[model samples]
Target: MKKPKPLRQEQILGELNQAPSLRVAELARRLAVSTETIRRDLDELTEQGLLNRTYGGAVRSLGTEPSVTERHTLFVSERERIARAAVPLVKDGRVLMIGSGSTTVHVARRIAVEMKNVTVLTHAFGVATVLAINPTIKVIMLPGDYHASEGATVGAHTVSFLQNFHADYAVLGASGLGQDGPADALIECAAVYQAMVSQAARTVVVADRSKHDRLFPARYAHWRDIDRVVTDAAVGSALAEPFRQFGVGQVLA
Candidate 1:
């Protein structure tokens, strides 16, 4: 049998736009090529600033906005690892607040199954549904203007609701993290995340390694505001140091 050719630049970009983060092995399988060929394609994409290379995969550039389903498929293992690391933080009778994102949804699902006597407050409709289905858990929905793409509430209504309530912990997700601060792809989402940060006693950021060092347009919280960041092993030492300098704790899974 003959070896198949690697994906061309256009095909790779198309795949990335559809699914932001993808491992070399997976891409090779999907494109019917060797892992080495996928690696070379990733290198080329990274050089073009179309993607950012991680330990085992590449994430689409910061400016590229992938759909929610696209994000859910990207970095699946890393997100699951982050969720596993975050699950332990939930305690009985504690009010948990979670943001809207793929990783946070996983964390919510784990909490629903594993924990008891918990109150989950979220602006995310999908998260609310996930926890609500678990009869053992108490779920609270914050009212706001619905943003269909994010599947969360945003705007003044949601912010106002959050201000009146406090949570023992807040699990947040970000588009990217940098030396200066945490950022999100959309400004409205950033505003809502910042509101959540202020209302929680301990703020935990649930970000996969792919989020590190990638820049976004709007700023939400700085490293100081985050109590801890739970990510995967792909979080490089170079990115971790700057966050530590700001007194943010980190847990690599």
Candidate 2:
């Protein structure tokens, strides 16, 4: 059966999340729809501010982060490896605070499958959902205004709520990982991330290679604030220098 227009449009955005740009013909072929249908769907999604029309097909809207479902389609293998590397850092029966993002979702999956008797506090609906699969894990949802695009909660409410508890570790994902440290594309999320960093005994940043050297507006923490970074990218002098300088450990997956 053919998917409805709304579902089909969502599938289009998911494809764009895997690869930022899309071509109409390819989208039509993959979705089993006519080119004209794909074009119309793209046009409607663009008008709705979910995506931007390009010369050929579409792209993610400027300054807009893809939804968690869309982001799950991206960097699958690398994210899996990074998640596996991060799992060894998590001890059994510890309290963890995790931030929102696709990579963090991968980490949550690892915690579900490989660990037990752990408590997780998060504002991301996706993270909480994944952790729920593990019977031994305790999932705590934080209070805040929900951001649908990211599938997470953010705002002063979320940050304030984090103040009441401390965790053994705070696992976070970043939009950019530069020499200065980890940063988020959305300013609202940065505050929640900063709060988690301050309240945890240690902080780990999980990011893929694409985030390297990029600069985003909301700098969550300086290098000194992070305890370690887990990624799939090979660390060269440029990336290694900052970690070494700040005494932050880098784990390559």
Report how far residue 13 has shifted in candidate 2, in Å.
16
List runs of model 2 lying over 4 Å from the truth: 1-64
Clashing pairs in 2: none
Q: Kindly list the per-residue Cα lDDT of model 1 for residues 96-140, writing each as its tens digit.
A: 888888888988888887887778889888788778768878888
Candidate 2, residues 56-127: lDDT per residue as tens digits? 888776444556676676577789999999989866339999999999999999999999988999999989
Clashes of each: 0, 0
List lDDT for all candidates, in order.
0.78, 0.86
Off by over 4 Å in 1: 1-60
Q: What TM-score number comes out for model 2?
A: 0.76
RMSD of each: 6.6, 5.5
